[model samples]
Target: MTLLSLFTQARTYLKHRPYPVLLMAATPGSSFAALPGAQAPTRGTGTSFLQTFQNYAFDGFTLIGLCLCAFGIILVGRHALGVYHEIHMGKAKWADLGSTAVVGVCLIGVTIYLVTTASNIL
Candidate 1:
């Protein structure tokens, strides 16, 4: 059939899947590993609780910062397009376009800062 209908059928089939059963089947030891008093798995790095919490918190903040930066880029791009159109129609000027470009560049720069800070958390 058509591509749209095929995608619709696939989406419908996947939406109602038995996720827990599939997850259990995917991991052969899932059911047996749910023992009482079982120790949770660790990477054996021996980091302290406070250090781990700091790492996780910083990582989450970095992720959120990066996401906001990307969203800013999208907003700037949309606004820049409108500014350009307005300039073309004589409703605005080149200064607005330049400002949009500057803001867009600054937002993308923040994304780079976030990525770099991920290695220096705390």
Candidate 2:
């Protein structure tokens, strides 16, 4: 109902769903799994320690990037929906709306930059 309650609900939701935020903050290495000299000797084996580690590391990076992008999209959508709801209910002021819009745009820009940079590195 009230602005404070709305914010509190959002905060609670974020607190509960922290994995996305964690993934968004992750900084996995840039190297791919099968580097020229990094591959284990027993390449055709079921599972070698080096191969497994490399595979997991590469997968972690990919997963983190995907999660970060998804989180950013979800965050922007949630904020936009919240703003729309507030406006529809006549509870959002012009200044509040403007500030929210600015923050959302900045967030989207940063998210795009991060995803693009990560993609390029990989």
Best by TM-score: 1
Worst 10 residues of 1 by lDDT: 38-47
lDDT of 2 by residue, 2-120 (tens): 99999999899899999987776663443444456654323242367787666566657877888988898898878878887898799986677778878988888888888778856
lDDT of 1: 0.75
Q: How many clashing pairs in candidate 1?
A: 0
In candidate 2, residue 18 scores what lDDT?
92
Model 1, runs deviating above 4 Å:
1-46, 114-121
Estimate TM-scores for all models: 0.48, 0.47
Q: In order, what lDDT does every prediction score?
A: 0.75, 0.76
In order, what is each prediction's RMSD in angstroms?
Answer: 10.5, 19.9
Local accuracy of candidate 1 as per-residue lDDT tens digits, 1-122: 99999999888877887696578688977766867883332323237887666656666676676787778778878888999999989999898899889888887787678767764653
As a whole number from 0 to 100, the lDDT of residue 71 in candidate 1 is 83
Question: Ten residues in a row with the worst lDDT in model 2?
Answer: 37-46
User: Candidate 1 — which pairs collide?
Assistant: none
